[model samples]
Target: MAFDYDLFVIGGGSGGVRAARLTAQDGHKVALAEESRMGGTCVIRGCVPKKLMVYASEYKESAELAQSYGWDFDLGPFDWPKFQQHLESELGRLENAYETNAEKAGVTIYKSRAVLKDAHTIELADGQTFTSKHILVAVGGHPNVPGLENADLGMVSDDVFTMREMPKKLMIVGGGYIGCEFAGIFNGLGTEVSMFIRKAQILRGFDDEARGHVADCMKMRGVTIHTGCSPTEMEKRNGRIWVKGSSGHEEEFDAVLWATGRNPSTKGLGLEEVGVRLDRGGAIEVDDHFQTAVPSIYALGDCIGRVELTPVAIREAVAFHKTVFGGEPTKMDYDLIPSATFTQPEMGTVGMTEEQAEERGPTLVYATAFRPMQMAFAGGEERVLFKMLVDKETRKVLGVTIVGPHAAEMIQMAAVAVKMGATKEDFDATVALHPTMAEEMVTMKEPVRTLD
Candidate 1:
């Protein structure tokens, strides 16, 4: 069979672009089609822009903290238009980079949506057809907006970056990382942020103590959190969004955001029609090697529902290339992958949760919560938490959870030790760096409680 290319990638996301570029660089003819921006979700709409906003939102408090430290300055109001202009420019630069890199690697770039017409054939949005020896799908996912009355009146996470004007009062629904992070972002930006969470606490499935600490910090920061609540309906009324909650409470806000969740972006890709099996959540199902049921096709990243982080997606792409193109048979390691939530008081975690470790065997838990030197010196009530979970028998550190400013930064280093299977005694043997919040990780001498 004559094939137009050796490989055809159906997405231009982090995973798809990497796969296409690598395969092309390996001297195989490859082509990639993207319906929208080349940088996909992470660069165009997700982490890059969101982290920039997080940084932008923190200046207000940073200025106040500076004043407490005897520095004098006045923090001006947030200028949304100016910030957004820069953000758009940065994203455009990133998209161009992705495209240029792929082209340099000798991959054909198509600015159109591509869908499967058969096991080895793709049909583009312009009715163009191409056949390939192999196909890779990395379409990623889309934010889910629940089916509620006038739900279209609410915006999703993707809509946040291009918002014309910052809302004076913002109502956010959902208890996941997205909802909590945005609550902090808007509240820090001077918006009256209110959160409606159905769960008892935000960040479900995370370390309980850490999540509780985050919720407390959010409350102290002036974000109103309504736990045990979810929106049942929403409508526009008098130039505002009126939301009715499942708990029968009603409220009005200038803007409402539905951060419920995201679903794999596999629609109209003609996946199942070509014998690609999809999970119940519409995520493409793949085996250990990221190979679909059909041998000629493969899938990875968010569309496969395996670790939906951008870095993880890139790793999967590398693994896919090694396995399929390089003959290395590599697989992405999902263990001990640290993650962070960029809230006002951030959270960083790696390895097992206390509950998961306890379920496996006896465990030892070491924890501390206190105001750090900087915050204490500034007379701020904010406290930082450091917790380590250890196996009672092996004495190995099972998990590490941190909640405070720069928790994300601290967790990255901690994850290295955890990934190496460092024991609690190894941590105790390391000398503590004095007067540092992270020193607590090494300084804790006793387990607060032992789980049997």
Candidate 2:
């Protein structure tokens, strides 16, 4: 069954949606195959819903912050059901928006699972096979459940957002970004959160100082963090799950969330049947331009298993479309990307960390941590930390990270400097924004320390 189209995309998540719609906009006949909902993991499960919970959790923080602003009133107990209803309604609105937008863009969408019967051809779940000149597997990633005793008792990131009722206690099983973010959401909503991680620290690959500050802030906010620990067994005891770990520690909780990590979402896609190469992590082996071993097939997003953020997926999808269809093509510059953790004291970073920059040569680390000016009267003791990595040789700013109010917003501006390959002198040359937390980027006076 050959279809007349220039491109076909599978998995209508962030990457899939953009690839299909944008390619269609370029006057290429494009078809998208999605097994479930059209909107990808980011819209339905990952980023959108999680951020909403973050915003919902912040209202509680706001009341506490209100005390310092000379406003006093009795805050009502949070209604979990009310929030769940609102979240569901908002999700409905988003689904409608996605459908309307795709239709307007003239993309043919197939609401069925797609698998490769042969290279350059996909079989729909409903017994339809469509062949295209180009096939993109943007299927994204899913929870990586570990194999441990009572591992079946642990819930993944997907289960956390769909929780209808509140828990007496939640013992989250992973200490990575997903687990840490959920820990913050649970703690902020007044649930006791205990975390277990295999490494000495949470967010193991992130900048050490920023990670340490976040771990401390989370601890202060009442999240019991357990490092260098792995749960060995689990059992149901007294209406709770009893978790016995190798650390010789035990805890009981209403439920367990295993935000341990995620792997590429290419399950049952039949890649092996068509000779597409897979990396160690089951990620589609793609070349520099995101082309798989078979050039007719392309893959991006979590399916490629690196830089699994939504924006990165979008960039990959956009670039893939442009390279194949657009007259001029641009390869993705993996560097200069910025991301933030929605956890307490919300951390944001762009470019090299102090540790990363040191591999080049001697590097200067400019760091400052203090109470936010707005927090001085807010009664809450929340603080912001800013760190920048610069080459002592060139004084060019390599990266910037902020862990405080609106850290994400701050790092976005800093990313421009990083993308332009700005040095330390570039940061020094720019005038400060004044009285805003963002000004900290241009206001560092001393090297907190130099790293080699």
Candidate 3:
């Protein structure tokens, strides 16, 4: 095939850049197009900046604890503008790194939106057309703000990163990871945060016990979490957004972030003209090989809605390249994908939840909740929880979830074990790393001490 390129990828975020670079590695000509920065939402506006802010916000609590740890403290007020400037600078650095790495790896980078011309062609916004043997869409997902009264007063998580000013009172309208994270971030930063959620608890998809622990922590930290509540209408009065709830309750806030959900960014990419199947949520329908309805095209990352996590996107990119151009077929396995949230206490989970394990068979769930040893002298009033979901019959570990300091770092190694089918013996056989918080995960006398 005399193709303009072997692979033409759209939306140069994590997934697009990975796919383009991997295709180029296989000696195939590849080009990727992006409307925004190369680092995507995670680096620019979402995870990366948010996590830094989380740490910064926690400094207030940390400083308060320092006084009890034999240290006199003189903590100054946080300058939001200073943090924003630093965040923007860091985003620029990461974006530049991705660009340089892509160029060095022989991937042509296009800075524009891509409109699909057909099953195998896309026209860049700049009026350049490229025909490729494979067209991969990695546009990712965007924050979805539903149609609500006074919607203009409400913002999404994306806009919060660029908030005009630090809000005095914030009302978050959802209880998902995005909303809960911001609730903790702003509350830790001393903004009165009120979260109104429709469900009985936040983090609806996570394990029930972990979710309960977070909810308890949130309430204890003075952030008001309203469950079984929905906003009936919203109005603005005297420079604030006034929210009316279903139970005839009313509240006002300087900002309302509606982190209800995200939908795939496939609306204007011309999917329908080429018979690309999309689910009810607008997620691209793909087979096990990640091939779309159109044989020559594929899609990955948030847009595919398989895992919707960042690492899963990277994994899909590798599998797609190996399958198509590298003369090897690879299918992505989503069994034990790892993920983390940057809420106040932090949380990380991998593999199946206890609810998910129950679907397969009767499961043995091991769990531990306690204060970390490091915190004894640190004077922090936080709890570290470690949960392991295992199969009672087979003794295979089904999942690992941790909520505490460095949860993300510790969970990754445990994720590898779960993915590789590690059992109780595997964990017991490994030696403890000593005096570290991670050692707690392995040294629990009983996974969960019961009242037997």
Best by TM-score: 1
Clashes of each: 0, 7, 0
Q: Model 1, stretches more than 4 Å misplaced?
A: none
TM-score of each: 0.99, 0.97, 0.95
Per-residue C-alpha lDDT of model 1 across residues 165-205, encoded as one tens digit per residue: 99999999998999999999999999999999998899999
Model 2 Cα displacement at 154 (Å)? 2.0
Evaluated against the true structure, the overall lDDT of model 3 is 0.85
Q: What tens digits encode model 2's per-residue C-alpha lDDT throughout 358-402?
A: 787888999999887888766657678999988888887788888
| Cα lDDT listed for each candidate | 0.94, 0.85, 0.85
Q: Score residue 46 of candidate 3 by CA lDDT.
A: 76
Instruction: Check candidate 2 and list the clashing pairs.
Output: 13-40, 395-423, 395-424, 396-423, 396-424, 397-423, 397-424
- Candidate 3 similarity to native, TM-score: 0.95
Pick the winner on TM-score between candidates 1 and 2: 1
Better candidate number, 1 or 3, judged by TM-score: 1
